[model samples]
Target: MVLCHDEIDAVNDMQNLVAAPSLRVTTVQQSSHTTLLLCSAYNFYPQQIQMTWLQNGEEVTSDVISTDVLSDGNIYYQIHSYLEHKPKPGEQISCMVEHVSLSEPLVQVWDPHPPRPLTERVKIAVGTFFLVVGLTALVVGIIKNKKRTAALCTVMHENLVAAPSLRVTTVQQSSHTTLLLCSAYNFYPQQIQMTWLQNGEEVTSDVISTDVLSDGNMYYQIHSYLEHKPKPGEQISCMVEHVSLSEPLVQVWVYFHCFDTGGVLLRVNIGALYLQSKVYRIGQLYMISKHSHEQSERGEGVEVVQNEPFEDPEHGEGQFTEKRIYLNNKLPSWARAVVPRIFYVTEKAWNYYPYTITEYTCSFLPKFSIHIETKYEDNKGTNDHIFGSEPREEETEVCVVDIAYDEVPERHYKESEDLRHFKSKKTERGLLPEGWMDTQDPIMCSYKLVTVKFEVWGLQTRVEQFVHKVIRDVLLLGHRQAFAWIDEWIDMTMEEVREYERATQEATNQKIGSFPPAISITETALPINVRNGPNSAPSTPLSTEAPDFLSVPKERPRKKSAPETLTLPDPGRRDSIFKLPSFFSWNSSPQPE
Candidate 1:
């Protein structure tokens, strides 16, 4: 029963026949210099209309009050809006009303200068009759008065509201401490509020804000500073509130943590992808921590080179380590044809239990990097604002990979690794049937934000897409294996797990290559595109020296088309997880107790 446009209009007409609104612009004396102006639209049909107050034909936003549409008890409505202002000479105030009944907006203007009293008019007429010869002198006086009125109006217009411009910057005070500055300028009115937020939570301590200062013009400016030590994957923002803005202005400052490993300074670029890990309680965390290490040690296609544990003043309570995953012969034939025989991707991680940050970088591709920020919680993946309140600059697309239902790669799939076929003997948590996610108990989810960047022009989109596929595969394979091999680490203590890491790291390093180089490396400024503006470089990471291993080859390899770039084989029955919509039903589930 779809109605045509004409029929819809006819129905609307029958329900709410056109009735234009009556508008009025009136003022009340508040003080000797101030006045309250009200612009009201009355008795409009359909209860929908718009009313705005304007000065000199420009719409006003500040010091305005409005009333909701009140019922006239006859199926009609009325609304009022007000603007309080100081009386200014030569200024024209108007009320603009818009409704469906009116062909165009109706504007009723109020004249500042009104007619004089009848006595004064009569006296002026008598004088004019007697002094007819002096009419030229009167006309010259009138022209001078008009010129003065125009000049006054120009000055009044200049003194109206001005919007503010905001800028945020970072300053490095020491190796680990950073200073963030948020500044807003060119705004009229001295009143403004500025505050600092870390991961969307306001920070009252260690924050300093300057008094709103005049800019010597008719505008105001203010500066806010936040002094802090660096932490992994922290988002700091400065929010400014002013009467000039209908909503508060927010400026985000993302903190990038840098640490030295061998002769390389690793700077992590932050990104996020929320992935679900359906497991019970602490078992989920242990499985993630231990299985990741075990997989690296057991893999044949890749080798784990260096695993160095380090201490940092900022992240003292957490585990800080650097690792290198050497990809020598693992590259596809097409990829191997265009690169050096020796190639590896560096992996640096800061593990703080449920909160962890891992970054991957390729020495050869200076413009490419992968950052992953992970947060573990004992609930369904519903905490949308766990990362930050402000929306990210990039559009976010969500992918839910059903480990049991989604198909796995043929070459890597194992009968033991299949979640639908394998069951755990000790925990009795295996042999997950179809739609098992609906009834899974004591569920926990791992929210991962994976950000990948490839700045090369033609290869950017395709390469990024491919890398995400590989990441999703890695996650899918790793989690599936974790559950299948749950008996291995379900009973290990924290100390035992640490000892296991030390032993396997040694064995893995021996299998990969010789000991890593120990040259000193200095921090460097990120590329201009990564920075917010010219002054965005924070003090701590002013500049970074290239790693020793990133030396230029004697010859440049010709660029080749990426393998499977033109057309990739269908991965599985389900579409690639990247192509999925923005959300899943499970994402809206209630927070787990």
Candidate 2:
């Protein structure tokens, strides 16, 4: 026992002797073509160490030189590494050091931008001196205005609790109607009232809302959805009454000619040439939608397995298209973990101009599907019973997304694309300032009724919620892109737009196919029922048989809830929706976004 204790003490003493490294990275030499960076580590003990260069998180294999660790003669060591490379735009260069003393790798980044010049530094110093002097004089002035300052503080305290941030966004859209979502977020005291008003009158019907819900941070959020069929010269807005505001806050809905699909309204200046605008916007939406799918780097991404645009006399007038978005590799990490590696979801759309019906179904899951009905109108979104005489489900959740005011992912943000700052020179429109919706002329809204279903018991709620989030993101991004790139498509003809879509879709399909795990194309006839008209949902499949990886498990049921042993749904059942197991009822209401 004494020997063991002595060994432990010796190890502890050795650990105590360890010294962590101090790193300094500098641009040692520079030329027009290449720059050399030197990274030095000082005063690190326990001689064994490793040093390397990294560019944007990846290891730098070439153009690297390292010096052997040298003793500092005071029980410490020093090492230096050199990296030489041509500078690339937006490339981050870093030096990584690993040693026995470090709990994790030590990194030092090289800043390409040089330190401030002496004159610039002197100017900043002078500015600071004047700023301090001004502050001192301001203090004297504040003493004379002490009573006024106190009154201002009292007003601030009375008004500055928490004011709700408001944004109106389109949750769903079709040919002639829009479903608008008005959301109020991050307010305190929990006493707030919201109302939808059209043309200065309080709207009484077709409004669905969520009760105020706590954000768990002493703040609350509520969402209200207004279904409206927009008309010419009509104004629609959300009125919020909160204690933080001295007066009620009003947010008007702005319907810009952001997208020019069939039923969407446009300014009369263009006259009958509006069809060109509609075609142009459709092309823009397709391109933007395609770009969103390419963000995933883990898999091959989305593939257009089949795209068939046809005309149906039964559906009346406009075009009908069936698109298959084969998402073999284009799935979120959470979904990809459980789904078969090779799977796809089918989309069928019946575009009848002012009204449209779109449906989504997954082949492998069989029980999961999404159905959406959309209508467009010339006024703010307010349309009730547009779908059918059937009463809409009261539990349906409405999410409003404001493209101009709502926050998008920071990585995707672009200054030129920001609606608050961007203005269209050709149309003399945009630069959408606060309350821009109140006065913007030629307004329209798209109303969409979305329904999602997942019959698997354990995964139903989670999957449905995830699908909604994904849908919202898609809608927000698509609308933002349409507005931002309006100039590119505002003048395109219908034929020109169709050609652009064809070329882009071909390029996108090629890009997905070129990725790892080579893909082969096969032709198979879809069921006749899949080609059936707009009223019925169809079970469409690219292939009849499941891949070998999707074969059922042989193990007997042992009370496990997984669907591994379950048989795939019969493709013959065309009209029947997947029913939930009687024991499992999904009563969970949708959460507000």
Winning model by TM-score: 2
Candidate 1: lDDT over CA atoms? Answer: 0.52
User: Which sections of candidate 1 miss by over 4 Å?
Assistant: 1-316, 390-396, 513-593
lDDT of 2 at 499: 54
What are the Cα lDDT values of the candidates?
0.52, 0.55
- Mind sharing the TM-score for model 2? 0.44
Worst 10 residues of 2 by lDDT: 584-593
lDDT (tens digit, per residue) of candidate 1 on 124-170: 99888879858877888889777665544434444467778886655
lDDT, residue 593, candidate 1 = 19
The alpha-carbon deviation from the true structure for residue 371 of candidate 1, after best TM-score superposition, in angstroms, is: 1.6
